[model samples]
Target chain A: MKLMVSVKRVVDYNVRIQVKPDGSGVVTDGVKMSMNPFDEIAMEEALRIKEAGNAEEIIAVTIGEQKAQEQLRTALAMGADRAIHVEVDEDIQPLTAARVLKALADKEQPGMVLLGKQAIDDDQGQTGQMLAALWDRPQATFASKVDLDGQKAKVTREVDAGLETIEVDLPAVVTTDLRLNEPRYVKLPDIMKAKKKPIDTTSLADLGVEAAPGLKVTNTAPPPERQGGKKVESVDELVSELKNRGLI
Target chain B: MAKVLLIADHDGENLNPTTPKAVACAADFSPEALDVAVFVSGDNGVADQAAKLDGVSRVLRIDNPANEHCLAAMLAPQIVKMAADYTHVLVAGSTFGKDLMARVAALLGVLQVSDIMKVESDYVFQRPIYAGNAITTVEAPSDQVLCGTVRAASYQAAGEGNSASVEDISVDAELPDHTRFVSVETHKSDRPDLQTAPRVVSGGRGVGSGENFDIIYKLADKINAGVGASRAAVDAGYVPNDMQVGQTGKIIAPELYIAVGISGAIQHWAGIKDAGTIVAINKDEEAPIFEVADLGLVADLFDAVPELEQKLG
Candidate 1:
């Protein structure tokens, strides 16, 4: 069985994002970029599943500009057997991205599809579920634990109430949450090997997928700043302050 | 006028408090009709509770044995079948909504507008991106059914007064067997829910171990506040993931937020940025949590928390 993982290029989690002054969008020029943290977790899980002898090949795919290949190469360095880069210069919303992944799923016919629960950039955690709906397959999202058996996978999802365990048949979609697995760092030898691995470049048209009409961003702005107050001297003073404000 | 269908979030027995918050957001647009769909396994009382929410025009009960687990795959097909009568579909941006709504939207051939914080108009809204660091205003085409998840932190729960009519509705959709419910492990707490609680007290890595969290809980019990933990604390196994408060965890907006021993990472700040009267108790004076704190106390949490709890009494 083959595992297909979807990785996305997003702003580094450590970087402080700033909205463009003109209210158009965020400033992404000259900023550090990295594979979405959750996607890294997904890739790590896929690699572990293969290492456990539950699966064989791992293919990492991304949809973005040419620079997105940097992320795909990072995935290759991490242990994906190969990579696919779908070149889309414009911003691809979740619906269009899911459509592209569905097309690839049809062509690759992987036994399982893996993705980050949500991209930290767009913050829209819709792609994986949308792909499952489009592909007419089961989806186990926000998965923290995955136990793969013959023709079946039991997934432990991190939900608001607590952990929920669900069983889905193979050829399904599983989205990774934060507690899934810690991603391994890329080694120098792996980086060199990844450069030699093939990356199949294609376009949305080549995949028979078109960008769907979607929500249009009208304005962008920074969140309202919170003001800091003076430090209190003691717990007594804090209690008194709370009392004075009717907060206690 | 826009016709809206709000999906109620519930366990098999009771309605989630966040469902009313979504109703509050959907009511903001003043839709011609605001109907709630309660998908449950049996004749659960959730639909009756949804009917009491102010501004709800009606409650549609979808009873099926397959809905016992609230699997998105099963609910999506049923929701799509009933979505033909409404112009917009909304749900609370809880884990349930985040897991379910996209599938419903995709089945309806539309893009979901996630985390709608402000409804600018029927078709326009504002949402946070980059983990609430930036807010973007977006517009959906009026031609298609608008699907969105209301950010629970951004709206209050609608009041319980009006009793809307309840209607039993059946959806003719094929439920898939590929997905099966196994079992769930939920932390049953008697304390106020973290999401809708008026006052919240959260601990961080500085809280030490799970046993050490007793002080945090004691302090919270004194104030009758809900308890939460930072991602670091949850990741360290000091608390359950459901109690996590951060960008990836539960976003909360309480009247008062007390952070004990929390250094306050950006992701954690995203959850509480909307909170009122923020207070931080960390020995690390340079902790980022103090920057946003309305009141800062540079002291050890172990000592300060106990003293504060005693004095509050």
Candidate 2:
């Protein structure tokens, strides 16, 4: 069986994102860009599945600018067998991205597709499920644990109330949550080896998909800042302050 | 006038409070434009609960056995079938809502406006991105049906005084047999729910080992508050991941939030930024949590929690 993992290049998790002063977009210039943390987890899970003999090949794919190949190279270093870069210049929304992935899936016919539940940049957790819907395949999202059987995969998902387990057949889509697995650090030797790995570049037209803006962002602004408050000398002072504010 | 259809979120017996809050969000539109729909497997009392929400014109109950487990594949097609009659389809931004709406939007060939914090008009809305660091206002094209999930914490639950008529609708959708429901392990607790609680007491790496969380729980019990843990604590196995409070975790906005030993990271602050009054207690005076805390105390949680519990008692 073959596994396809989707990786996204996003603003690093540590950086404090600033909205553009003109309210046009976020300030990405001069900011550190890294593979989305959750996608790294998904890639780790895919590597483990291969090591466990459940999968024969792991393909890492990304849909973004030329710089996104940096993330695909990182995935290749982390253990993906090959990389596919769907090169696009503009910002693609979730729906259109899913369409591009659907085209790839139709061509590759991988046994399984893995993706991060959401991207940290847009926080849109839609692509995986939308791809599943478009492909008319089963989807197990927010997966914390995955066990592959002969032709079935059991997924444990982190839900609102608690954990829910579900089973889906092969040729399904699985989205990773935070606790799936701690991604392995890319070793120096692995980084050197990744340079030789094949990365195929394709365009939206080649995938037979259109780059359309499904959701329009009319305005962008910073969130309202919370005002700072005073310090209390002691626990008694804290209690009195709570009482004074009628919060107790 | 535009008609809005709200998919109710609930378990077998009781309705999730977020459903009512989503209804409240729908109320932002015309007064008599909202319709609540409950889809359940058996004759669960959920339809009755959906009818009690204020401003609902009617409640549509769709009964089908496949609807029992809240499977997104089974629910999405049914919702898409019903969505053609309404201008907007709304649901809460819970896990169930996010999953179901994404599939529905895909089947309909549209985009889902997720976690909308404010509804500017029937077509325009505001949502947080970059983990709540920035707010983006978006508008759906008028030519297409608007589908989105409401941030339940941003709105109050719709009142229950009004009595709306319940209509039984028959739904027939070809649900795929590839997906099967297994068991669910829900953390059963008697404490107030973390999302809707009036007050929340959260601990961080300062709480130490998993067993040491008892101190935080003891204080929470005294104050009748829900217990929450920072991502560090959850990652350290001090608590379940569901108890984590941060940008990727549960977003909460309680009336009072007491932080114990939490060196506030920006991700954690994003979840609690909407909290009414924040109080931080950490031994380090320079911990970032103090910047937004209404009351800051530079004391060890071990000694401070016990003393504070006694004072509250």
Candidate 3:
């Protein structure tokens, strides 16, 4: 079985994002970029599945500018067999990204396509489900645990109320949540080996997928800030204040 | 004329509060007609409950065995089948909404406006990106039907007053057997649900252990508040992940939020930033949680929680 894991290059999780002054967008110039944290978990799950002899040949794919190949290299170092970079210099929305992935899925015909539930950059958790819908396949999203059996995958999903277990047939789309698994650290030796791994680059035009029309960002702004109140003297004072405010 | 179709989120027995909040968002734009689609396995009263929400015009219930569990695979096609009569489709931004709406959008060949924090116009919205670090105003194309997931925490629930009529509508779409619901494991807690609770009391790593969370629960019970935990506490195995409140967890907007021993991370702040009044109790005076807290108390949680509980009693 083959596993295709999708990753994205985004502003580092630790960086405090700032909107551009002119309302163009968030400041990304010279910002630290890394593979989305959840995608790392997805890649880690794929590697574990292969290590358990449940699958073979993990293909790491990304849709971004040339710099995104850096994340694909990181995926290669983390145990992906090869990489596919859909070279698009423009910012791709979820719909366009799903179209690109669907094109690749048609070419690869992998048994399962894995992705992060949402990108830390956009925080729009849509691409995986969109891909499943376009491809007319099953989707198991927000998965914390994924077990692959013969032509079936039983997934434990993280939901609002609690955990929900579902069974989906093969050739499905699975999105990873935070508690799925902690990603493995890329070793120095593996990094050097990844340098020699082959990456197949393609463009949206070549794949017969035009960038889909989507939402237009009109402006960007900082969220409203909360003003801090004075500290209370003690727990007694806190209770008194709560009562005074009719909050208790 | 925008005919809006809002999807109702429920537990097969009761309508989730998120549904009414989504209704409020839909009502904000003042669409020509706001109809709700309730998909259930049988004669669940969810449809009737949805009919009572103020501003709801009609309740369209789709009864099917495949809808016993909200599987996105089965629900998306049915929604798309009924898409022709509506100009917009809306759902709550819970796990269920985020999981299901995108598939519906894809099937309709349109892009989705996720987590709509503000509805500026019929076709424009403002949503948080970079995990609430920035907000972006976006304009969806008006030529096609719009799909959106409402941030329930950002709006008030639609009050129950008008008794809209309910209609049983069957969708002629093929339901797939590829996805099957197995089981769900929910915490059997009588405490108010964290998402809809008027008050929430959350603990952090400083709470020490899972056993120590009992005090946090006791304090919450005093005020009839819901119990939550920081990602740190959840990661430390002090509580279940479902109790987690952070960027990756439940975003709630209660009347009041009490943070105990939580040195707030940016991600955690994203979840509670919409809260009305925030109170922080931490031993470290410089904890970041205090920066946003309306009231701060620097004290050991072990000592302060017990003292506060006694005082409230």
Candidate 4:
């Protein structure tokens, strides 16, 4: 069996977010960039599957500028055999990215597709499920646990209350959640070997997908800032305030 | 010139809060531009809520026993077929909404825009990226079968007290044959809806012990608020994972958010940034939580807890 994991290069999770002056987008100049948090989990899940002998090949894929290849190599440094680049500029629409992925996925025909539940940058969480639907396949979203058994696959999703396990047929899409597993740092030897790994490059146009404009934004602004609350001197005062407000 | 179809996600019978909230977002996007109709896969009661929400033109009631659970495998195909007749589709990012939205968009050969905070027009949506660090304005190209998932807590339901035209239809859907529901175990908790609650009180590693985690809960109960926790608190077993409010946990946009003993990690702040008011209580005034907090109290949680319990009691 084979596995395809999608990762994105985005603003580092640790950096503070700031909006641009023109407000078209956020400030990225001189800021840190790294692999998406969920994608890291997806890559780690693929690595775990490969280690379990369930996967023969693990190809890391990303859709963005050339810097995305570095993110892909991070996956390779961890354990993937090779990588693929659906090369495109930044600010690519989810549908367009999905179309490019569809083209690559059709050619690769991997038995499984793994992705982070949402990219740390976009947090859309739509690509994997969309891919599954576009290919006429089943999908398990926000998977906390995934286990493959024979022809059937079992997955536990992170629901509102707790884990909700569902079983689907093979050749399905699975998105990773927080509790899935922690990603490991690439060792020195693996990092050295990743430089020699081969990555196939493809274009969005080659995928036969035409970019048609759909949604447009009229305006953008930050959410309302929280107001200040005065502190009560004692719990008795708080309880009285609560009672006056009918909260108690 | 196609109409609209919304997969009414009422968790079987009752209309889930998201269903009405999605209607409000669709209303904001394009009122009367599309014929908004809701399709409930489970209970016909969802048909009952069609009247209460704004912007709904009709309700498609599919009372099928096979539509027992809102499983993605079972509901996606039906939504795909229903989507073919609609120009746009809207679903919330709630548990059932996210799954159905992805499946419906997939069946229609389109990808959905998830957790859209606001929609300005037919073609553009404003969504947060980089874990709420940045916002991106995206334009979806010519695909008319638009699929969107709205954040449940961000919008209000349409004003109640109106009835919608309900129509019952039998769709010879390519019924889902696979994907079995093993069994459901509904773990009950006393916590309010994390996303929609107006007031929230959260804890972190500073709370120190699992047994002591009740401080936040007690504080929340006093104010008719919900309880949340940082990823650290959840990871430390101080609280269940559901209470976690961070990048990967639950995202809450409450009216008032009080952080007790939380140092305010960026990941945790991402989930609560939309909170209307923020109060951070920590011994270390230099904690990151203080940067965004509207009020910072430089006091140990231990001193604050008993004081809170006593005053609020």
Candidate 5:
């Protein structure tokens, strides 16, 4: 069985994103970029499945500009056997991205697909489920724990109500949540080895998928800023303030 | 005339409060728009509650044992079949909604607008990004069927005076057989739900241990506030992950949010930024939580929490 892990390059989780002056988009120039934190967890899970003898190969796939190859290299260093980069210059929405992945999935014929539950950048959390729909496969999203038993995988999903454990047959899609696993640090030796791995580059035209974004961004702005309040000296002062504001 | 379909979120017994809030968002589009609520579950009682929601024109019930669990694969095809008559499909921005809508959008060959906070027009919407620091307005093409998830926290629930007519619908679409529900482990709490609670009292790692959370709980109990925890607290085994309030956790916009011993990381602040009045109780005055707090008290939570609880009582 083969595992195809989807990774995305996003603004580092620690950086405070600043919207462009003209409200076009967030300022990405000179800012730090890393593989999305959740995608890294997904890659780690794929590597674990491969090590446990459940999967024979791990292929990391990413869709973005040429610079996104950096994230694919990181995924390779994290233990993916190979990499696939779908080069696209413009912004691709979730549905189009899912279509492109579905095309590649058709070609690769992987037994399972893994992805992060949501990207920190767009926060859409749609691609994995959308891809599963396009491929007509089962989807177990927000998975905290995964156990592969023969042709079936038991996934523990983190839902709003609580944890739900579901069993999905093979050839399914799984999205990783935060508690899935701690991603291992990439070693210096592995980084050098990853550079030698093969990365196949393809264009959207090659996949026969058009970049049709269903939603358009009309405007962007900063959220209303909250003003800081004065510090109280004692519990009595706090009580008085609460009373004055009718908060208690 | 626009025809809108709302997918109801519910437990096996009752409907979740977020379902009515999503209906409120759909109602904002047009007063004359035909709003229909779809209850896809094995229980007919869920559909009975859906008929009582205000603003809906009717309730469509698709009762089947396979629809018992909210599996995205099993529900998306059924929804797509029913979606041909509707112009828009909307759901609450809960985990179940997000999961199901994404698949439905894909099957319809359209994109899903997620976590919509404001409905500027029938096609335009405002949504938060970068957690909550930035707001972006999005416009969907008018030609395609628009599908979206409404941010229930940002809207008021629709009134319950309406008695929409109920219609039984049979699903002929073949259900996906790959996914099967095994079991569920839910965190049952007697207090108000954190997302819908008017007031919330959250503890962080500074609260120390799981046992020490009693002080935080006592304060919450006194004010009839829901109990929440920071990701650090959840990671430290102080509380369940469902109680975590942060970017990766549940985003809440309560009337009043009290931060007890919380340092207020950016992720935590993202979830509480929409809160009306933020009160911070931490020994470290320099804690980032004070930056956005409506009232800051620089004191040990161990001392202040008990005193605050007593004073409120």
Candidate 6:
């Protein structure tokens, strides 16, 4: 069996994102970029699948600029056999990203496809499921545990209540949540070996998939600020303020 | 007139209270104006839920017990074929909405303009990214299936729409043949639904321990507010990560958000950015939570909480 993991290059989760002066998008201004944290977990899950002798091959694919190759390399350094880079201009939308992945997956046709439950950059949480729709396969999003028994696979997803289990045959999609697994760092030796690992790069045009211009993001702005309250010293003072605010 | 198919919420076998919410969005962008139809997938008893939504011209109740489809891929094709007579389709943006819209749109070779908070003259949508740090408004190109996910909290769930006996639409049983849902595990909480709770009392790193969360819970029950936690709080083991609200956690937009002992981090703030009125209690006046808070209380939460509890009593 083969394993497919989807990775993405995004702004580091720690940095405070600042919007451009023109209100177009976040200004990367001197900020470092890295693999999306959720994708790291997905890649970790794939590597685990490979380690358990369940997968004969591990492949990682990414949709972003050329810098994303570094992310694919990170996956290779960790434990992937090869990488595929879908080179695109800046500002790729969620649907476009899905189209690109679908086109690539159609050619690869791996038995199991895994990706992060949602990318922190967009948080759209649509691409994996959308790709499954295009591929006409079963999709289990926000998976916590994935069990494969021959051709049939059982996926446990994290929900508000607890966990929901679904069964899907092979050649299906399962997206990983935060609790799925802890991603490992590449050792210096593996990083050196990753430099020699083969990486395949392609474009949306190469896949012969014409992406319909859907969901054009106009502008992005931060939400309103949350204001704070007063420090009442005693119960009497608290009541007085509550009464004044008509919150009683 | 071209029909617009709307997926209404089905409560049990009936439509969900949010079905009208879906129809309102559908009617807004319906090509035929008011020529909208709704479909509820359940037993025959589910038809009344579809009939209750306002402005629904027709309703379709599909009952096929053997037609077991769980994932969006399975259900999308069903909705797509049902929507063949219609040019537009709308559903409230919930977990299922995200899946259904993405799948339905992909099957039709179109991508949905998703996470729409408000719908105006055109099918304008506002979606957040990088968590709530950024919001983007988008317009989708014209397609046979115009799809959008309406935020469950953004609209008033209207009721008392036109009553109708929906015709049973016969869908080929072969549509959703691929997927199987073996079982579901739900996170049972004694508290209110986190998203819909009007008054949400959240804790942060200041609380110190998971046992300290009981205080927040006590206050939540005292005021009937939902219990939420910052990623900092959840990460510190003060609460479950599921209760976290931020760029990495759930997005909460409530009427009154009472933040206690939380030294506001941007990640935590991003989650609660939509709260209408925010009241933060922290000893540090310099805490960022005060920057956006409606009321800033700089004091020891341990002392303040007991005082407030005493006053309420």
Which of the predicted structures, 1 or 4, would earn the higher DockQ when compared with the native? 1
Better of 2 and 6 by lDDT: 2
Query: For each model in turn, which proportion of the native inter-chain contacts is also found?
Result: 0.88, 0.83, 0.89, 0.51, 0.89, 0.73
If candidate 1 were superposed on the true structure by all CA atoms, what would the RMSD be? 1.0
lDDT tens readout by residue for model 2, B87-200: 889899999888788889889988889998898888889999998899999988878888889988888889999889999999777778999999999899999999889899
Task: Please list the Cα RMSD from the true structure of every candidate, rounded to 1 decimal place.
Answer: 1.0, 1.0, 0.8, 2.9, 1.3, 2.9
Error of 2 at B39 (Å): 1.2
lDDT of 6 by residue, B78-132 (tens): 7777666766677776555665677777777766766666665454677766766
Give model 5's docking category.
high
Residue A12 miss distance in model 3 (angstroms): 0.6
Instruction: Please write out the lDDT profile of model 4 over residues B254-301, one tens digit for every residue.
Output: 777889999988788889887766878888867888778766677888
lDDT: the better of candidates 3 and 4: 3
Q: Deviation in angstroms for A13 in model 5?
A: 0.6
Candidate 1 chain B weakest ten by summed lDDT: B11-20
Interface RMSD of each: 0.8, 0.9, 0.8, 3.2, 1.0, 2.5
TM-score of chain B in each prediction: 0.97, 0.98, 0.98, 0.93, 0.96, 0.85
lDDT of 5 by residue, A1-248 (tens): 99999999999999999999899989998999999999999999999999998999999999999999999999999999999999998778988889988998999998899999999998888999999999998899999999999999999999988999999998989999999999999999999999999999998999999876667887779888889888888888888888888888
Query: CAPRI band of model 6?
Result: medium
- TM-score-wise, the better of 1 and 6 is 1
Q: Which of candidates 3 and 5 is the stronger one according to lDDT?
A: 3
- lDDT (10s digit) by residue, model 1, range A1-248: 99999999999999999889999999999999999999999999999999999889999999999999999999999999999999999998899999999999999999999999999998999999999999999999999999998999999999888899999998999999998898999999999999999999999999999899978998999999888888999999999999999998
For residue B50, give model 3's deviation from the true position in Å: 0.2
The ten-residue window of minimal lDDT in model 5 chain A covers A211-220
Model 2 residue B53 lDDT score: 93
Per-residue lDDT tens digits of candidate 3, residues A196-241? Answer: 9999999999999988897899899999878888899899899989
Off by over 4 Å in 3: none
Better of 3 and 4 by TM-score: 3
Give per-residue CA lDDT, model 5, range B22-116, as digits (tens): 99999988846545555455655877787888888888888877788767788888899888888889999998898899999999999899999
Model 6: CA > 4 A from native: A222-248, B1-3, B9-24, B27-47, B66-70, B159-167
In the range B1-313, model 1's lDDT, one tens digit per residue, is 9999999999878888889999999999899999999998888789999999999999999888888889999999999989899999999998899899999999998999999999989999999999899999999999999989999899988999989999998899998999999999998898998988999999999999999999999999999999999999998999988899999888999999999999989989999999989999999999999988999999988899999999997
